[model samples]
Target chain A: MTASTAGPFDTERTRSVRGASWTAFRAMLLRDFTILDKRLPQFVAGTVMQPLMLVFVLTNLFPRIGQAVGGGGGASRFSSLLMAGIVAQTIIFIGIFSVGTEMVRELGVTGEVEDRILAPTPIFVVAAEKIVSGGLQALFGAMVVFPIGAFVPSTPVYLEVRPIVLLTLTPLACVTAAALGLTMGARFSPGTASYLFGVVALPLSFLGAIFYTWPSLDAVPLLQYALLVNPLVYASEGFRAALVAGEPHLSLFVVYPAMIVSAVVFTVLGMRGLRERVLS
Target chain B: MFLVPRLQQTPGWLSRPDISILRPRMHSLPPANISRPGGTVTLASEGESAGNGATPHPGAADVISTTALKKVYPGGMVAVDELSLSVRRGEIFGLLGPNGAGKSTTVGMLTTRVIPTSGSAVVNGIDVVAEPARAKQVIGVVSQANTLDQGLNVWENLYFHGRYFGMSAQASRAATNDLLERFRLADKKTAEVEALSGGMARRLMVARALLHQPAVIFLDEPTVGLDPQSRIALWEVLGELQDEGQTVLVTTHRMEEADEHCDRLAIMDHGRIKAVDTPAGLKARLGGGASVTVRADGEIEKLASQLRRAVFTTEVQVVDGHVRISLPQAEGAMQLVLAAAQAGRFRLTDLAVSCDNLETVFVKLTGKDLRE
Candidate 1:
């Protein structure tokens, strides 16, 4: 409409993708944290309630009523055994609910996923950011185990800290859970995701070695081998090795490699599934 | 796999006098009844060029071009057939069509949302399918649906978008603040995105798209849910964007808006472009004619026969309960029509005349009105 129109574009901004993806990844992760910052209370409540309440009721209440757990040490031994399981399962659940369920919701009718799909980065980078952010949330959820393990059980529950194993297993466990969540988010539609939670959640918690070590399931040998197929079994065994190493648990060899394999496999599956879901 | 060169290969388009000659000749149609009555609608020059005078960025480079693009869903639904289009930088181009005419599909292919089953689309010198990430860097899209991050407040939405474009935190914050001020959204910076009114939300979206200064912006049916006031406000912003040399592509069924705002419009139907030209150029194809329509209380076909011999009637056609008469120009055609009607003993109720416009062009090309 004007003869003296100005080319308003600021093309001087460095046109580059070489440094773009990393910054985008960090910013996307920060976006999740920004939302998480507001929902901190809800997140804390949702994350800690199930694991802590499970620990208190089983270790504190059950002993009071003489319907105790554990082989010999009764309250104390069961409390220590239960601590690692709770930490492991809580980490995995955080990943499932935070990354998996959130993915399902964003990808559903709301189409919130569309907001990030065009981030000037590879779609997989966007997907990987979800896993990392979810892993971070799962890490915070795992911390809830320490305080609950310390104070909630009427009996003294000792969580011996093996610094090396704890630090390594912590990230590995969190990432594996988040990666599995990514896969679930990609797999389930809104209508069936709830049903998936119902069918999958109970089995994962109960058969997951959450209340007992996988070694003890030797009394039920068929069940012990079958539990190997569950990803959470490796996380629990790894945590038990980290927190209750003096007790009977799976070997450090089996725990580390099994968890590593699970992390790698789920990450690959999750990334591919996410790509299929979004690109079509 | 149809690769369209940036400009080297488009000799057919470049050699044409103007964009109007990029034209596909009007689709063939069954002849409508016409009678000259006593004399032809005459005493007027027929070769005058388009008069609305929209100048789409002379000598500007192509910001977007698509050639032989096509998409077929897995279930065998062809959303967009082989379609070719070009948009110039600093021009506001409109894709005008009714629902399911493949406007959105075409936009989707260009925006990197919908994958094409075949053919090529390039945006800002990047092939969209092959280098989508680079293409995405230059193009911003405002989708028809509300895809804002409902979880974040308005300010955070713009802030994070800047960050996603690789801006530093401080820079992102600064850009977000400036955009909020420009769009008159500074007061509502902290408001939840879902809580903003329709106009505010749309403005926020446009701001978010511009935060990184993308080369082109695509708005798919941008005014669909907006009220008249909001619609005008949005167009005002678009006009300003055009003056600043921002290329825009909007898809809509609204004829008047397209005519008023777009530098050029590509009329599309049934998954292909029916015509593409400046609004004035498309309407000019109807000649320097004016059309008059009259509703009557008698056999319509009988009135059509009577009007065929009217002194100034150039063409006559019956449509949707009214008889329409076309004239070289509307001067004195109304009285002649009325006089001819009276002599034939047909009672006329009322009549209206309009200069040939986009709607008439659309109907003439597609055989149906746009509102459908």
Candidate 2:
């Protein structure tokens, strides 16, 4: 039959043809997981292994050298601080490596970005989905770190587990980490991103306030200020502030607000960067 | 030779509400204001150029428009100038140009892939830039790069695309089954895309583009890396799409493809459209009905200049060993061409003349080879 005769079309067909926003969002998430599902093991080892090893080495080896250093009390204190810092490090590593690397691969050699770009959903949403997925990976990393940090060397940094603090901040920290990942992924070309882990990421980790308290770096005053630039400082401080509240070492007041602010700022900047990059 | 599409029978339009016309702010322009240079139409306007209501669909020979389309790179490269062009709905519109001439860029803009620099276009009254989501619903895009998913089987790919377009899984599978049988992909339904040869992959890509039943399908160098057999297969698929009452916009540097397959095309250069027309229209506008080439032993230019003054010759030039000339008609002019060659004291080594195809018209307008 001729096409002219083929239709007794309804006027509502246009409206009926719409894709569900949530369905579209879910489809994107499902597709990404399907594609990367095989790589989950790699993510787990990458996230969990480093934190466990760092906790072991710092908690065990450092206490012995404390006497000669004359800052032995500070060393033990530094070790506890370092445990929180290690958790933050795991989050950063997972965020940067997992989401950032996948994005580079998607936008670059594979041309998979086309699938995401052409979808009915906005590009920022797709980037956010990846960021969210990476956040899940960071959460998994934190779960592993909590048990190890609490149990190692038997002097638990105890008694102040504010369920509210733990619940609220863990998700926030993961999101912040993911947002930072998305920002890096969206902004850098894959060629530039090739060096992300070795160069950009490592330096950010060292200066991220992970290993030491922000106020304690007065010995190297410039270093103290410089560390403030890193997002990890906020994350670790937040985690420590929540997990070990009222501890003699750190204050919760500074950590909570700072982390929240950083997460909000990075999320906005990252999402904007993603939109601009994709639309371009 | 035109391969008449099996599906070429015109489809009846169902009386639907003028959904677009209800908007009080749509851009309106007179029919004549649409520019068709060298026979191809471009909607190159800034502010509301997209008209409201059920105007003639671009394939119907009436209107092709774009609205407020802009594509600005993060690194800040303006690939497409804020440009618009419109074609009378049914006329074959050709977009012609050299590599990086923004032919692909314009195609990208029109297909809703790369956003326009700052303006939008409407293909058959579908707002391409402003309502790209709506626009894409009616457009099929075959990018310059191959977009066929390599992991899926051929039928699976078609089925998935159909589902992606909002068809129910059952309906999509049914349609996919039919298409697979029709495209001869039924036998290859279980075979992975990577296993297919180059020709098969190209065919599959065309199949995937059509699965959604888009109104206007864009082909960006569909035959770029294909062997002759593969290219011919792609042409057949395109011919079929056109036959099915679908408007097709194809971008290619292959003059022959544009000349033969395209109903009309625009010649593009340096991010601006140089000319737009049917292959025949472009040739006629280039000062010759069509071009013919002849090879003579010595003094080719002298023979060329002599042919230039002849009554039958419109324009003539000698390049390499060949004397190229445009004649008023390809049939009768050959005798005149030979006579002129003989009278000029130039011996014809080899001579051939045919209707002026896209090659001559493109070179004449762009001052560059079409293949380049």
Instruction: Tell me the whole-model lDDT of each prediction, alpha carbons only.
Output: 0.78, 0.62
Query: If you assessed candidate 1 against the hidden native complex, which CAPRI class would it receive?
Result: acceptable
Candidate whose DockQ is highest = 1
Candidate 1 residue-wise lDDT, A1-280, digit = tens:
1111111122223345556778788889989999999999999999988977898899889888888478776788898889898999999998888898898888875677776887788788888999999999999988866788767888888777788999999999999999999999989899888965687777988999988889888889999999999989988888888887367888889999899999999999999988888775
Worst 10 residues of 1 chain B by lDDT: B36-45
Model 2, residue B342: distance off in Å is 16
lDDT agreement of model 1 with the native: 0.78
- Taking the tens digit of each residue's C-alpha lDDT, what string does model 1 give over B1-372? 111122111323323333223221111111120121211111111222323434455435456777788999899988788887767666798998878888888988898878899999977667889877767777788888778898899999999998888776776787788778878899999999889988888888888887776778999899989999999999998887776567799998899999999988888877887776688767765434687898888898888888897653558999998998878765677887888888888899988877767888777766764443
Backbone N/Cα/C clashes per model: 3, 54
Cα-based lDDT at residue B44, candidate 2? 28
Clashing pairs in 1: B1-B119, B37-B309, B37-B310
Query: Once superposed on the true structure, which residue ranges of model 2 sit more than 4 Å away at CA?
Result: A1-20, A59-83, A144-160, A213-222, A244-250, B1-63, B67-84, B87-93, B112-119, B146-208, B287-326, B334-352, B369-372
